[model samples]
Target: MSWKTVLNEIKSSDGVLEVVDARCPNEFRSKRLEELFNEWEKPFWIIINKVDIVPKAFADRSKKFLKENSDAVDVVHVSSKKFYGFWILRRSLKSYFRDNKAKLVVVGFPNVGKSSLINMLAQCTVVSTAPVPGHTKGKQWIRISSKLLLSDTPGVIPKEFASRDWAKILFPDDVEESAFILLEKIKNAEGSNFEELYGFSPEPSEETLERIALKFRFLKKGGEPDTNRAATKLLNDWNNCKLTAWWL
Candidate 1:
């Protein structure tokens, strides 16, 4: 779906839930969306999804940071897979609006678990889900409660990211380059366990890719390390949530 369609959905809803990955909430959260919410005079809550993957302390700190840094009505940490934090989320919305009926729209970048959160909220698979980005292709309204409705929108990046490397990394044309970018972020991010995840420290360099290739025995016909294949594996691990990192 287009940004114009997403904006229309936001304008029509009573509020918005900006879902983000708890592992790296800061990187995933969109300031442009928040600004748009503010401009529209719409109340928004930041839903930090996949909190099960991060330490409670980290999640708490992230929530605190977002609460202090953004204009969201509330910052909620949740694990849609574990069905965690939905009670608080529901209560927060009802408490804020002081009504039994509400219409909330869920919005976020690709692969941040927007669809999964809606499924958990609705207590079933109301929309298709996959680990890949852009799994949700359109908008759908789901009745999550007797008087509450939630609209699930296709994930979108801000228009400002049109020329950014992170945007390119999302639907990358070069897997090796994308892996390198992700590796650099992980290397610099707090609480990253390079040795624990890969059995060796990472340098965010070509040599690191070679090491990953050799360790995984991803070799070419001439027995050379297949860095491209190694890069693919690294990206797969990231998308599968096998790799973990968080930033304060």
Candidate 2:
């Protein structure tokens, strides 16, 4: 699916469009989501979640870029980590709902923090939230109030979103890459560090994997962690995020 496809999906709906882009900064940037904003003739709001994980400098820059991208857009920073910006998002719901008090559809790439946002606003754990992708398979409609109806859909990867370069830059390509990044940064760490890094714990210890790769002679002659192969496996896993279990 192309970015245009997402736009078309929203346009096709009868309700007012409140395009919820739940993807992280990296995924958002890799797809050049801002370009979509520039291409859109209509105005939209951006509720960028996981802000606590993203640096303030980056967030500030993204806000500026988003604002400049569209006249009708407002970018808000949120981190479902602490349930920040939920009220701001609820208040921002006005621009789309208007006097019609119509249904508002929330759409974005899978695992982009949509369910968590909904749970916060509804004050009920009606929807599931996980770090892995492709968790939601069908349409799930949630009513926030008499005036507001929120609908959730399965994560759909746009056909035009085929840039591997973009993908790697945004999300960690796989568990290995995530593990390696976390491990390399560890002054002194454990499974919890890796768990927090990728949002999941591996069945085999990451260190065990590293040792196994070495035992199998997968390492380069240069004595590196064979991160290249490790990153490749991880990217594949991440790209096909449906294989992973949802965070329950």
Candidate 3:
């Protein structure tokens, strides 16, 4: 998202609730958004979402790292899907708006559960969900009650979002490259069995994908393995938390 769009959302909100993926802390955070919160003097609360996919220690360490790096108003770790740690965030918001109604703008990178959290808070599917990044478009100002309001906008991309950075929001053709990046991240992370997961060593080329195709029996006509199918499957598994050795 452009800075102007984010600015508009901030202008309309009383506070900011930023959601981030707990599995990949470094990749999900946006310094630009945090700077905006500080510049506007708005309370900045971070929700380290998808904590259920990773270990508890990952969230704890990530909370510490983020708190030390940024002057956020508060940081809470939770899983939006299963509603873990949702109570803490709910209580915090309720307390903040006890005497006055509060309107908060939800911001985050794509695929970080911004819409899902809104649904959880409203106890209904107020916003739609798409697994593909950059799928959410437009905005809505939802009224939960007299005490609170929520403004949901499209996920914001960080200033550092570019070729050098991992593509959080990917096009269809970008899936293979994104999957390769995801594999490398797991390979470099502590205690990850990236090689063992696919039953083959990692390589910059199609070696990992070829192995995956053979392992999963993803084949083309005449029994030739389909690497594209394998690649997509691997990516889907990683995204859905079916394939993750370690995360922090």
Question: Which candidate gets the maximum lDDT versus the true structure?
Answer: 1
Tens digits of per-residue lDDT, candidate 2, 108-194, equal 554556656666655533343222234245445565555555555423445346355334323654656454543342323221223
Candidate 1 matches the true fold with a TM-score of 0.88
Candidate 2 segments whose C-alpha is farther than 4 A from its true place? 1-9, 14-43, 124-139, 167-248
- Report RMSD (Å) for each prediction in the order shown: 5.0, 9.8, 5.7
Rank by lDDT, descending?
Answer: 1, 3, 2
Q: In angstroms, how far off is 181's CA in candidate 1?
A: 1.4
Residue 88, candidate 1: Cα error in Å is 1.3
> Sorted by TM-score, highest first, which candidate order results?
1, 3, 2
- Residue range 171-201, candidate 1, lDDT tens digits: 6779899888888888888876667978987
> Candidate 2 at residue 75, lDDT?
68
Clashing pairs in 3: 1-157
Local accuracy by lDDT, each model: 0.80, 0.49, 0.70
- The alpha-carbon deviation from the true structure for residue 148 of candidate 3, after best TM-score superposition, in angstroms, is 2.3
TM-score-better candidate, 1 vs 3? 1
